[model samples]
Target: MFKLFKHLAFCAAFLVAVSASAHSFKIGELEVIHPHARPTTPGIQNGVAWFGVKNAGASDDRVIGVESPIADHAEIHDMTMDNDVMRMFKVDGVPVPAGETVTLGQGNKLHVMLMGLKQPLKEGDAFDMTVHFEKAGSVPVQVWVEQPSAASGAMQHQEDQHDHSAH
Candidate 1:
């Protein structure tokens, strides 16, 4: 019967729609287009992953959690400055609002701390990480390991030189 065929087609279409949304984790007003990540060290169990998140939407969103297979733990961390001393702390989340971009960069050092890595992360290698947003759910970020050299990290505050200079 025509009605029976129409019912079947409708059910099929509905199932497809649900699956499309279920497959991806989303971010605020952004698509997380081709997300990439890289670790900090080579031949070491400890590592970090950086991502370039661009806001494609009109409103902002924040990152709250990170999940990955490389490590038993993935912590959301931030660097804090106290007078002449600098320290790192684990934060619950990070905000990347709409119409703006947030880069997980070196030194100012917001990182995805990969603890208990099965193996060392090397440059030119990429791995999978799922970043969770307050509203965007969990989006997968592909991370690659690239060491930050002295030329880059040394010129910056470096976290090694606590000169107490107020520039």
Candidate 2:
């Protein structure tokens, strides 16, 4: 039954993304590859967040920004490597091609970041988040809070260096 529902949801999402209005695309769910939690260290209202999104539609979509009650601002962030130093900065927009899935994983590659969060987030908690696509309209996505675990065997590894061991 669970698998059935999962397939159904995916199918529905695919349908929505395909039937979007002109000049606009649609998304269904945005999933955090491996959600983790931590208490704010200091001088930070909330910690940054990351996740992946899949769009199975006929048109291109661009993830712009997001809005949530938990954060004062949400935006797309891209990671850069500078002479062995890693850096993170906001991207003007994230493009999602038709029938393709965009991954927002760790190593500060491409993901959503909730800046100026109103509250702290932890594992086992669920929060409502919205993803705004340039051509696609915003979609209400649920972010499931998770914990830091060595389960994936690549939690500490950089996003680009992760081997396809999970497969």
**Per-candidate local distance difference test:** 0.63, 0.57
Per-residue lDDT value at 30 in model 1: 61
Which candidate leads the pack in TM-score? Answer: 1
lDDT of 1 by residue, 51-152 (tens): 656777877788888888988888876666677576567789878888887766533567666667877776767788888888767777666555554434
Clash counts for all predictions: 10, 2
lDDT of 2 by residue, 20-119 (tens): 4112223453322322333344455544555555666677777778777777777666666666755566678877677666666533366556667676
Candidate 1 wrongly placed segments (more than 4 Å): 1-28, 31-43, 82-85, 149-167
Ten contiguous residues minimizing lDDT sum, candidate 2:
21-30
Cα TM-score per model: 0.64, 0.62
Candidate 2, residue 38: lDDT: 33
